[model samples]
Target: MPGKDSKEGKNKNQILADLAMADARRMIQAWTPPVWDEGRRPRISLLRAKKAVPSADGTDLVDWSREERNLGWDMYDKNFFADVVDIEGHHYEVFKFEFIEDISNKMKKALDDLEWVALDG
Candidate 1:
């Protein structure tokens, strides 16, 4: 019972979400995770919201919606809160950027797989 415009909007939203998710993965993978010795700790705060700038041609670019940003932020915050990784004798607070990056990758993968399945079906 959906109207044509409503259906089109839904499709557009889906595409936008997929693109934003992909951008998130790229942002996350661009930086290497910090590896510090037990005596040293990172000084970066991981709780801050970061702006993800996805580079793509105008036709390919999906301007990230507020919902997409919030979704990415939620993933980033979850990783930031669950960060007490121990390496050897060194206890390192996982780099927030790295954590968020990994999360973005995971999200993009999931969304990509879903999009593929939808296309196939």
Candidate 2:
């Protein structure tokens, strides 16, 4: 049988996973894609929070706003390509995707530690 510490660690990781999922759901709900057509109505703001990290320059810092903005753009592309977002009802289908790996082409195999990290609000 596994020890108490091992069980505790697993439980903690599970909690983190649950929290991350919730945050992701909220992000999806809050995002509004830019208007594409004259007849289509624009999306209104709901909620927005970004993910950030410390830059290689240390204190300089890599901001999450950029990444979040990029993610939004990528999402728009995906929607356009897939025709997933509804312009009439403002409803979007929730899809699962990896943050750094799936969205970033150049980032492939570049980010080791952050490969598994999910976007945070």
Per-candidate local distance difference test: 0.42, 0.36
Q: In lDDT terms, which candidate is top?
A: 1
lDDT, candidate 1, at 86: 17
CA error at residue 31 for candidate 1, angstroms: 2.2
lDDT digits (tens) for residues 18-114 of candidate 1: 5786887799779565556753432222222233333333322322432352334354333322222211110122245556565465555555665
lDDT of 2 by residue, 1-121 (tens): 4532343344454456547767877897897856667534432222222323223333211232343433344655533321121111111111124333333432332343233332321
Clashing pairs in 2: 51-64
User: Which 10 successive residues of model 2 have the least lDDT summed?
Assistant: 85-94
Q: Which stretches of candidate 1 lie over 4 Å from their true place?
A: 1-10, 39-121
C-alpha displacement of 75 in model 1, angstroms? 17
RMSD of 1: 18.5
Worst 10 residues of 1 by lDDT: 84-93
Could you tell me how far off, in angstroms, the CA of residue 27 lies in candidate 1 after the best superposition? Answer: 2.4
